[model samples]
Target chain A: MQKNYWRSNLKILSILLSIWFIVSFGFGIIWSDSLDQLQIGGFKLGFWFAQQGSIYFFVILIFIYIYLMNRLDKKYKDKSEEKL
Target chain B: MDTQVLTYIFVGLSFALYIGIAIWSRASSTNEFYIAGKGVHPVANGMATAADWMSAASFISMAGLIAFLGKDGSVYLMGWTGGYVLLALLLAPYLRKFGQYTVPDFIGARYYSNAARLVAVICLIFVSFTYVAGQMRGVGIVFSRFLEVDINLGVIIGMCIVFFYAVLGGMKGITYTQVAQYCVLIFAYLVPAIFISILMTGNPIPQLGFGDTLVNSDVYLLDKLDKVTTELGFNAYTENTKSTIDIFCITAALMFGTAGLPHVIVRFFTVPRVSDARKSAGYALIFIAILYSTAPAVSAFARMNFIDSVQEVQYKEAPSWFKNWENIGLIAWKDKNNDELIQYSSGNALEGVKPDFNNGRGLSGERLVNNNSDLSNSNEVYIDRDIMVLANPEIAQLPGWVVALVAAGALAAALSTAAGLLLVISASISHDLLKKTFMTQITEKQELFYARCSAAVAIFIAGLFGIYPPGFVAQVVAFAFGLAAATIFPALLMGIFYKRLNKEGAIAGMLSGLVITSAYIINYKFINVHLNSADNWFLGISPEGFGFIGMIVNFFVAFSICYFFKKPPKSVDQMVDSIRNP
Candidate 1:
């Protein structure tokens, strides 16, 4: 049961980190040159991510995590209480 | 008709209003002092929070900072605003639920240790002081600019005003004053932007003014700004010339830092209910977005105006505003050649408000060139960027009443935040330092007395910082955000959600994070300053981003220690369950 939580936490962490990396580090920094080639309403894709897009993502990520954490807390809560 | 008399009248009137409010709503009990009696309306709390969070830096320097750094300055806009998200979703609600008087109180209880609270207090003081120093400087700057007073004298005058209201009502005083400030500053901020926007884009709303195509021009506002600046050997205003890593890290750090700031978090605690706290966060951001969104437009408009009006002009034939700003000492023009076509002034461009020109010739009959002039040349044109916002009205030739209102608004921004910061300092000394650590059984009256003294001391120290600011107002503020990011942010997040994380691990994590993060910033800012326009910052990660590194280290160190240490008290899981259940 402990191992299951550990596994789930790792999975969530990996998914979160990947999103963070892709938006900020990948599109914003690493793949910036390629992104600059593409424009969003006259703003380069890379530049947009750097300035505005990632902030929006950050807001989304926190909400997702908050919602997920609340659910996780519920799932891992005392089964004895439910049975009673 | 003197500007000084007008300034004194408006400032004095505003001061009278704040003092009167303090007398009416002065905190009668500790709870009232610390959390505005936990009865603030959501929108009211939000307005106060906006005022508290948007300090002198936001009021005076943010747009100018953005104007100069071009696209790279998004780090501040994104970082500061992004922190609100972190605050809303992660930190604010839980902290409010935690039901603590101060951040250190939460840390102390969660860790079940006084040592942890002490560390938290230390970091809070360090961070808040760094921030307060910037506010002090901003106060001095505004005073010197508008009232034609010396910087030191201006700071002292500011100190007395802050001491007046902040000394009375604590959080209650600040909250009410901040609401009033929000009105004045926002009006001051927007009225000019609206005028400028309408002039440039035929759009009255500053937010829309930014992206709209320029009037009688083919290009968007930002694009035009980009072209003009780039042509004048400045970075293209809309271009992302910073490394992605820096932007990411800095923005992340600021987000967490905002969430961690005890003063800002404490604002949410003023509301009565959990639902109120959550609702307040949304409303606070909405109020802030009014200024935040409008700011970028103002910055763009200002930059476009700056370049359009002043680029490639002969010394003699420079525009009237240039000579005006030069007389105050913001911009200088000089030719090495003994040509009569040059103008040069320095120290402060806006000092005298009108360049006398002394008949358009240097005393030596040689033109000053490239901003070099004598030390005594108080007449030299040296405009501080912080002046950009306050001076925006006059620079764009707005009405005198609008300019007067802007002055009032500038004071509102500075004073509201000052009151908030002073409240925190008072609480730390009164509640944490005196009541908890020293005199454990002190009476309420004695505690209040000590609190007042500590506030006086803190104001004095803050006054000193204002008189002689160590750095630009915004950079000093970053230290506050950085310290909070490093210390409280990680611990609070872990404590609320991770039941297994114990006191020992939290202390270690917070201390290590504080030490490491501050060391990085200190090393960069003071010990080893190198780079062009701070462009050589790591991963292009400026000092603003350094705290994110510290936060990660804190989390890892904390988790690692947790793995080795015992689990938190059995009660922690139950508490977490209760919070999550709701």
Candidate 2:
């Protein structure tokens, strides 16, 4: 049961980190020009992603990770208590 | 009140508050000294970490750098903050679970080798000292500008104040003071920005204000800025001219390096539980993001204000702030075309308009023309980038109190980071090297004494570096990220994730990464400075970008060596499991 919890935790981390990479490096830099053709309140979309949007996403991503991990920790605790 | 008097009063009050906090929270034990007794609330620790992480460079220099770099400056905004993501998800929780006092302590214990610990300590000192030099210089700059003190005297005053709190109260004092400093610095940063934003765009929010239309014009603020800058022969405000590969490499390097920085990593150790450390990192980012996102807006506003206000004005009719800054040798203008007007543009057109300090108040109007050598009309004004943030309130015609607040905030930013780095330097020497490695028989009280002594010595050395800084050390601070990313980050990350990463592999990886990164930076930046240009660069990757390459090399060497050689002991594998599980 603990092994399963660890595996899930790793899975969550990998997924979240990949999303971070895609938003910051991928959308912000690599495909920035294409996305920049559009506009958000006068900011070039790609430029906004690089400077403003990506940072906002990073904050949200971390909080989500924190919330999810805390839940996982509680689940592991309850499962261990039942086994004991 | 006079600006000087206002500055003195504000700076004095802040200093008194910091000293009072120091006395109130004096550390009684090594635990308190190293990690604030590990009793700090996650929120308070988050605030302290924000103060500790955002140094003088971030406070005084970042916006100014962005003002010139334009779109290229996004690398700093993204790169500096993105590392917290890596820190929170990959490293912070695991390291906090390990429950170590210092970063080197973790490296030593996890790798089960004192030699590995020693190498980590060497890297820590090198990076921290280089970084603190910049902070001390920042302290001097703020002092010389506001209080009218000599730069050397400013550094000494800064050194003494840092010593009082850092040595007396230790981490406990520094942490609480950092919380206070965070408030002062962030308020100081935002107040002027808000005023300028409202003035420029009729919007209160600086971030939104930058994208909004100008107060009277139909065009967006950025669009207006782009038009004006290009007209003056500068790059468009929203477009970047740097190669994409270079941008990608630099941003990646900075992010990885930020995750690896020891002073920042150690802040997580102050929070109690692994869970708190994770949340604390997020909160820290929220506080940091407040400023990081605001910086670009401030940059754009300042850039537009600077050009519009002074670009083609007569030298004699230049703004009072321009003349005052000229007196301090920060702004210089000459009528290179003998037209008695300042024509600001890009390039070396202003190369010959030297400021004559012989009259003791800088070059006055007639003297400026008499001393001018060239006939070029394109460039006649030279303004230093460091002045952008400090001069913003004056240029915007803000109140005296706001200008004084900027001085206090710049000091707060510099002093807090300097204290944090100085503490890390002392801890590595006293606890990691002396207690753990050399003098293992020392008592707790004796260890505390050694820590204090080492801290004093470190501050003195940092002060000396600040006063008569070697030219190479001036540029070395930029590569602190590169160095930390290459040497320390990889070792710590592999020590946790890969169970088979033995001491030999870790050591080999760290040394190779250190040597390769340092060689690349020094060869181009120092040994053959002319070869540092893009055409001569390795695949056009600048020194700042080489850290990512170095990090990859570190990971490759460690994994390959571990595959061929002995795995870590069963005990070490058990330790990894314990760290991971928690």
Q: iRMS values in order, in angstroms?
A: 4.6, 0.8
Per-prediction TM-score to the true structure, in the order listed = 0.85, 0.97
Question: Once superposed on the true structure, which residue ranges of model 1 sit more than 4 Å away at CA?
Answer: A1-84, B1-6, B314-330, B336-383, B471-475, B531-540
Clashing pairs in 2: none
Please, what are the lDDT tens digits per residue for candidate 1 over residues B1-582?
655577777777887887788778887778777888899999899899999988888888889878767777777766777677667766777778877798888888888888998999998888788788878877776776677778899888888878887878878877898888888788878888899889988888776566678889767777666666666555677676666677678777877888898889889889998767767887787777678767766777777776555444455566554555455555555443434444232233333333233435454332233334444432333345666777677667776667777777787888888878888988988998888887999998888788888888999889877876774555556577777888899998888768788988999999899888888787777677664235666557678788998899899999898788888777776676555443
What TM-score results for chain B in every one of the models?
Answer: 0.90, 0.97
On a 0 to 100 scale, what is the lDDT of residue B79 in model 2? Answer: 94
Chain A vs native chain A, TM-score per candidate: 0.85, 0.95
What is the C-alpha DockQ of each candidate? 0.21, 0.80
Worst 10 residues of 1 chain B by lDDT: B343-352
Predicted structure 2: lDDT: 0.89
For model 2, how does the per-residue alpha-carbon lDDT over B1-582 read when each residue is reduced to its tens digit? 899999999999999999999999999999999999999999999899999999999999999999998988988999999999999999999999999899999999989999999999999999999899889878988988899999899999999999999999889999999999999999999999999999999999998999999998889988888898898888888877788888888898889899989999999998889999999999999999999999999999999999888876877788888878876777767656667677888764444444444453234453343344344446777777888999999999999999999999999999999999999999999999999999999999999999999999999999997788665654786579888999999998888778888998999899999989999998988799877888988889988899888999999988888777778889898899899887
Docking class of 1: incorrect
* Candidate closest to the true structure, highest TM-score: 2
lDDT of model 2 at residue B68? 90
